[model samples]
Target: MTASHELRLITLYAICARLFFITLIVSASLLPPFDSSHKTILPAADPRSLFDVFVGSLLRWDEFYFADASRNGYQYEHEWAFFPGPSWARRLVRSVWSTGGRRTISSLSEALFTGALTNCLTVWSARILYLISVECTGSASVARISALLSLLPSSPAVIFHVGYTEPLFNLCSYMGMLNCMNAKWAQASFYFMLANSFRSNGVLLAGFFLWGLIADPFLRKQKIPLLNCLKSILYAAITIAPFVYHQFTAWVTFCQDDGLSVEWCKRFPPLIYSHVQATYWNVGFLRYWTPSQIPNFLICSPPLLLLFWSSTDVISRLFRSHTQSGLAKQASMVLPHMVPHAIHAFVLTSWILVAAHTQIILRLASSMPFLYWSAARLILEQPKLGAWWVGWSVTWGCISSILWAVFLPPA
Candidate 1:
């Protein structure tokens, strides 16, 4: 809060941001060269392998199906069955890029570009998270610490450098959170929608915004008029429209292909479905048997534990101060707003646990920014304890990173 403190925080943020960028550049340089021979026509029936399947789906879009009938002269199927609209857009982009006679960038270049974009988004998201904490708690220290923790060089940074979707999702989610806190409902809805499109987990933004609106003292005092609320809801609906369109297209394609209604459950084999069902039934099951999967489980467990512990502390604090000062009254007034955001976080976390395959570690890493912010706040309240806690977290994070790199499978 002091001038000196503000200066120190700003300095810390700048240094961290610079270091993050440097780390990204160095890591990208260490990656293997992109295989030029890997390039081929869109949708090669059985497409060389899984990596090809993913690249073709991402870059060519028209190759997202299993049939070859739709392919005009291409060896692979042009079945634009699932999410056809996006495929058309992708095709257009590729056509234009080709016509320009620009050499196709290698896969390594593509990966690096994506990684750079993701890291930039991560920085932006960290700033937004910092802003939200400042707005909600009115503590500059909280904001600074939250931003720093969000950028920790662990799973999040690693995922960003690998062309994963987590960084982009984090950016949109945090932007939505910031907009919601500021009572910019339309903007919040737009960002939330973008986040959801990238990953279904982004629907959590809707819940977070709703809570912020209801809890905000200004909004509660008629800052958000009925007309504004209606407009916000409409904006949210518009944003969600694309997802609806995608699902509809997918369904129509499926129906046309099968000549009958498609059953979602029947799509997956019975054995795999049964395994997933069992996992869902057992919340704390340690039944992962694969050597590769064990590390993932270990990496994911610490964050869940931290989330649980922080939630308990928050609840306890809320109750302990319930009968005291005007702060209590303010908190009581705000509790309703907090409820929805809390619930949304819980739902998103649970969904990650249940729906995720072995990749749950990476999937849930996006939520670490928010969770770490919460944990940081709890620790900040107790100076000595906070210092100890942060020290341990940093130490463990470093150890984990080294162990992960050492055990990583050879490329």
Candidate 2:
């Protein structure tokens, strides 16, 4: 790397390190006392809390399982209801603690490990954004801008501190993308599958991987033979099989218990329309509520609205350029690669719309690392102004996130 590139990497790493420390502090503050109330600090109970509950229940599975069943039926176990595949991993984690009467230490250690995993993932996601920006723009400065923007306080606060799957899912998504770019189909498929296991929408990475494969220039020179194609297909299937099996099991269980169809549409109706209306209402102008909630609303709305506008502008520009560029040209280039990202944004938006839940924002924030790079590349032809705009936006976003973290209620 050149001197400038090294400098950019160092600067971005420093910013990420700062954000990581901040996230750790915030997350530590939010940890519940060992014997305090069962209620969580955050507005909605998320995977983190559920993970904690699962660990606690492992100490007395029979009693806790039946009690939870009596109280909330299957709903109480919904979060831990991973399919047969992850059950072994869960058991292994439990086994580590069951060896000694160190349950408390085990629980705390689990929480800390999860938090650290999330922090590392967010940092890796930022690094991927930096790499993509450097590739697209061929400028160390632009890459640094993308990396710094991704490390802005909002993204880290949401991912590391908020106790969501966003960080892990984002890391896996980017790993899949990176492996695909390097033509490592098997590794790409594995990370993509892991991402899917983390979150339902993570299958989007497969679309990204396919786009990367089709767009690769090497494929033109060395024609994809039948064996290669078969290998790729097998890799993709192996990556997807676990998630499919998990879904199938869930569907069977739902049908057996509820006596109803278990189609994806029935399970999640809004998936059909891309959940556009719901996405808009939840994260857009409609997010503002009554005066009592205005402070919280104001704190959350700016980054969300900015992200919405940025995504909209991207879509609008694509549509406007379609006729001039031609569908085939665009499809083989940036457009198709970007489609998976757009789908990710849409899915995240839909979740926000339906749930109006706070943690969802952090989940969607994972996509911003990629989106920010795209935004920088799109506008950076104007160099000076583009740099200023990106810098200012990042500065404001960081300030907003810090203030929000300082003042906002726990979780």
Model 2 spans > 4 angstroms off: 1-105, 156-158, 161-163, 213-242, 252-254, 257-359, 374-411
Q: Model 2: per-residue lDDT, tens digit, 298-369?
A: 555544654566556555555655556643354212443454455456556555644554434643555545
What is the Å distance of residue 183 in model 2 from its true position?
A: 3.2
TM-score of 2: 0.60
- Backbone clashes in candidate 2 total 0
Clashing pairs in 2: none
Candidate 1: give the clashing pairs: none
Each prediction's RMSD to truth: 8.3, 8.6
The best candidate by TM-score is: 1
